[model samples]
Target: MGRYNFKLPDVGEGSAEAELVGWQVEPGDTIVEDQPVVEVMTDKASVEIPSPAAGTVVSVVGAPGEMLAVGSVVLVLEVDGPGNAGDEAAPSVVQPQPETPPAAEPPAGTERTGAPAGEGNYVFKLPDVGEGSAEAELVGWQVEPGDTIVEDQPVVEVMTDKASVEIPSPATGTVVWVKGAPGEMLAVGSDILILQVAGPGNMTAAPVSSEGPSEAPSPAAVAPARATVVPAETPERRAASPATKPGFATRTPGEKPVASPAVRRRAWEHGVQLQFVPGSGPGGRITQDDLDAYVESGGALGTGAPTGRQPKTGTEDVKVIGLRRTIAKRMQDAKRRIPHFSYVEEVDVTDLEALRVTLNAQYAKDRGKLTLLPFLAKAMVRTLPDYPQINARFHDDDGFVRRYDGVHLGIATQTPTGLVVPVVHHAEALTLWECGAEVARLAAAAREGKASRDELSGSTITITSLGALGGLATTPVINYPEVAIVGVNKMIERPVVRGGQIVVRKIMNLSSSFDHRVVDGWDAAEFVQRIRALLETPATLFVED
Candidate 1:
């Protein structure tokens, strides 16, 4: 048996390190080639690194939440035959072997070179992915300037208000320049990036330089064509200042906290403001120990019980990234593009609750139990036909509203990552049981981060519910392009005047919002009332038109 040191591969473009999320396999566990071994997260996404060769895990390195650099050993494996570790280890004794004469040089035009022929500067443009949109918002960059990239490697992600997509590189090369920053809009066919390639490229006709090994000049023999001037370090600059040094307890005012990504993540999770926590590392750099000390000192203001009544001046600025950023941008765009008007209405679900309980008690064994959402979904599916204007996508740019006959319900779900709305396609055709099942499936997929693009988008109208944690009321932002969004608040038993005397009744409020441009106030109210009528009467949900 031979030992293999499995290192973390470069999971993200130009990412030097990744946060170790978890290990799928433990020590002594046998794994096959292509089996997922560890899960890590870069700034962009969480990726599961797979084993390149089958082996039994001998040992594992790094804990969850630790930042591991690319190519660093994360696992030691025992495999059949000689492994990579043996080849990499230093030799104890030198063994002499007979040397052979070098091979003859290749003929002209057949000289073997490392780079591809005709390599040159290639300008990659933003492709039109058939979204019919003229421009797309730059979400984030996967590769940075000066980073070497391969063909088909995702360089950037862009959103066209309809969907988000990763733009891959057309040719492999070194990135010389990038077009735009995140949040900026770039037109289709516009240059996205410029790459420096080996051969004659798509742009410019500079002749390729070809010099033989024997003809190559030494560094001292020839003055360089372009000389790179490096700045000289002065004695004071070379010496570490307290501010720039690592092992220090405090930092200068307004200086950002210096900590490793892992330590920063830990601090964020603990809600310990790094600004208030004095670091013990060089240059006032915060470490894991420092974060632990701050938390133990009861100085963490983000979580746990309050330390004191003293004014908490510590504030941490968190740069939103990935899905959170996408959500923020969509929400901001929704509010800005669509004039929203909110409508709140209360519903009596006493009979509905009784029916739900009875159904769950009866069907919980054979069939899956149902939630209030399925019932609400059934109500909306029935009600939308009466007010087609509410179930539509408004192309504000085109000055038109496209209402659909089929209902694609978007169930707004909150996951460990962030908010995502999984669509329940053809909800109008699905039975109550099927609707409940689909919602459950989609919700699970979303929460697990396994939801596909089809499952995540294409909602004619959306229904967002907080379930038990839902408060009394909430004005939900409309899922843009779709004219309306229905927000379900908490369900509670409260005293209400019924008939003559006050009686305890189960009540829930529907806080819904609509695009005022397409849906009139009366129409929105009427549409919600229709749903209320269907839900309040639960029996009507089964009766078809």
Candidate 2:
């Protein structure tokens, strides 16, 4: 028997590692070529790794939940000779080889200089754009199936960890098919679109007079023209440039602008005309900061006015798929397998807000600004010692609870694609400034869809805040394997009794959900109350240490 080692290929774009979500076949199982052998969960999406060569599964290198680096030997297979195994009837599996066609004799109308007559057809596969990005979201399609497309025409828009990028057509041709729909995730090297050239109609149109002397056309006889014939713009190319129509104002001759899709969307939502804004970015590109400054200065469109209208309502039936789908499955599993309890409390943050303003200005340059998240993260780290149960994870098989001494705070951030929680390792050890910087970095990466697999995994506890959503309070679902999660609500001005008279104070709500089987309700409530007290009396956080 011949042994074939099938290592884990680079599944996602630029992904270095992947978590083993599941194994389809175990040792000694007979598997066919192209059969899925394992399911791997990368930061981008969960993908099933198929067998490259047909063989019997000899052994698996790792267990579920263990991370495997790219190119690592995931499994070994023992196979009989090619003809004796399941691959017997399969077509020859040979490595790709480039073929050069035989040179054609000089035609009557053209000279044969050995250069290929027409551009060779190329198959455009999905490209890996981000680290650990396995699949990409099909956001939009510029060229439809069966439409004649030109080379470099934007064929589709795919969302990766970097941003939504437009995949251009490789060669001019009629698009034969599109493999996936909008919002669908396509794996790397997958054939996204197929094209058929308009040139070769049939083999019957050959040389009518093959017997005649193969004489090349005379240079003097060839008519020389000042202008060249440009191919007619196909429908696909026309569709790409919406501003190319008549009467549309063309951009002034200058450097081109650069802005992300999200930034452009935000500009559209604010009803700001981008053409009028004096961009400060490189090459005169409008940036998010420029947009913000324009809005602050009341410079152009919708200045000093309310934002644009709400988006049109539409019922979206999105299948639980991709990273969001995995998150849902894990959450459901956590709720079913682990007993959970929640605790809620309201806190006055009047003094905390004042302190935040002072510290923000004090460390303005080094540490952008001090947000409530870092302060709360610090408070949680300090209060965990009092209620260790809240920091413990339940190990049902062993009938023992696993408690952690240091806090790995998972900060949840929402992106255009879905929700991602990037962990801040050893939160207790980080200073307030360091914690703030980490939070800023992680949140920005999460929002921009650039968080790595390690950054999004292995958290002891989680914190989710929807202060931007303007909700009073919410019980956040606990991110599984970990025992508890804390939620932060909007800070609003409310009437409060100060000594004897009514006073206005800024109050915020805090809520927590814990594994009841591991942590008692009393411990959960006490832990939340401790965090609330720190926020209410901001001085206590600094004084207690």
Candidate 3:
């Protein structure tokens, strides 16, 4: 059979290499044209690579976890004909090369003299839609290769460093080929689909060079009556136990044992595992507090034991992968690029808490419990008009701050993976109940990894809360590009003098960070104080003109 060499193709965003994460096919395995062959991880995301021609895999060029330069030979396959003997006759593979303009092809159906207009076949490449600078992982495919797709319909969901975006079909036609599978990374300029159009007199023509074997049968041809199907998640068993293996049971003969990664890491770092510790996590997993308690109880990591030996230092290597890496890059950019400052205040929210409790009892079934966030958001929106500077963003290039009239407040949420801030669009116009409902919806979506790019961006300001975790005060970081962020802490009981009588009262802390270049300290403090006043009085929050 003729050997077809599939070289790593250029994905956009200047990516020249990718890590081979997984392989779907092995040597000697039969593969269909356009079927996924491998999965790759790049700085941007994980992606799948599809077969270029129907063939039997002859050789795999690389091992998983190995970094392969783009345009390199990833795999070699024997197609419909005998293999080429000379190296010159075989497809030469190299690492991925920089993006170049693709060669033009003749319009489809033009081979026939009486072909119908608008019936030409075409191949569509995934476009660079946003400020995306690297390859994107193919998280999912709405349609398989060879499946007919309609214009404007979403065909694939690509996960970039920023967010997942759905790629839409470019035109209505029969899908002739697909070049990648779910979880494979595809470069920005890469060809994602090939389409064939039915022409006049019911004529059809091939899109590729005739020297190659005939194209594989389209999905429509083989399954004409089948309905469109959505893909489902594959099931796999995962480890469910927490017992330690034989070799890692103890530290040294004299060292006390600490269970779980969180406790061990902290104890090892702080040299506190020498004392007795208790576990509180799943399956009695040692938690951070256990290590803290041990340290407070006079524990030490043996007198001279050099603090865990610096992890055998050599090359400081790190892989920029997943959500944590994305957050790091964004935060770094924000700090380096934006001018920031801080403002703080404390609010007496006793009245607001009473109102919330009353409302929850009144609309228990219809609206659930009301949170401080919605009320705070409402107060911020109302105060924005009086201290407009706090609601503005500075444009460094133009030397002006653009003040926004509409309020879009981003709520910072913490998830198992990482922290995400999803926005509540047009918060100023929505009622307290509506704001509460929207906040709940967005927060839930962010926790579930279902927040879209739009939901995560375009915020005029942000609100961050540690909820019960935050004690009396905290200084929150501004979500860059947004000029201000409000930090809400837990409400606690403290002694206060009321009419010369000492009494305990519920009080909360309000800390706000702002872009000092845009908003002055005075204005920022005033804005937070206004919110604090509204919360303390409660009636002011529901005031109508």
TM-scores, each model vs. reference = 0.51, 0.52, 0.48
Kindly give the stretch of ten consecutive residues in candidate 3 with the minimal lDDT sum: 234-243
Q: What is candidate 1's CA lDDT for residue 459?
A: 96
Better of 1 and 2 by TM-score: 2
Residue 199 shift from truth in candidate 3, angstroms? 45
Name model 3 segments beyond 4 Å from true. 1-320
Task: Report the C-alpha lDDT of model 3 over 1-545, residue by residue, as the tens digit.
Answer: 57877777764446666655557888789999999998665433346679888888877765443455687677888888765433644434322221223533333322322234666545566676443355876654555545666665556656544344455665667665565544567887665665665542122453534443232333233234222222222100000012112222323222223242223323433423222455554434455565676556544322343666467543322224456676787789778877777666777777788889999999968976679899999998888888766676666777877788888898999964568888999999999999999999999877654565567778888999999998777777788777889999898988888899998888889887888777777777778777878888889877886
Model 1 TM-score, all chains together: 0.51
Q: Clashes in model 2: which pairs?
A: 12-133, 12-134, 13-133, 14-132, 15-132
After TM-score superposition, the amount by which residue 541's alpha carbon in candidate 2 deviates from its true location, in angstroms, is 2.0
User: Model 2, which residues run further than 4 Å from truth?
Assistant: 1-321, 365-368, 395-400
Off by over 4 Å in 1: 1-311
1-545, model 1: which lDDT tens digit per residue? 88888888876445666656667888789999999998775533456789988999877776444456687677878899887887563222121111111222222122123334665556677776432568877655655565788775657756543234455677778865565655567887666666667775555432223652232222122223211111112111122222332432254432345554445445544544455678676556566778788667656422343667878665433446445666899899998998999999999999999999999999978789999999998998888888989889998788889999999999999986578888999999998899999999989878765576567779999999998988999999999899999999999999999999999999999999999898999999998898899888999888967
lDDT of 2 by residue, 1-545 (tens): 76676778886546676655567888889999999988775555456779988888767775443456787666777887632334332212211111212223323332212213552223456765444678887654555544677765556766654344555565677654455555567887655554555443111112334454233221222223101111123222222234232222224422123444444445433544444456665445566778788656654322133478868664433334445565677778888887777777888889999999999888878767888999999888989988877776677777887888988899988876468789999998998889999999988877755576678777889999987684886877888778899999888999999999999999888877888877887778778888888877777787755
- The 0-to-1 C-alpha lDDT of every candidate, in the order given, reads 0.70, 0.64, 0.63
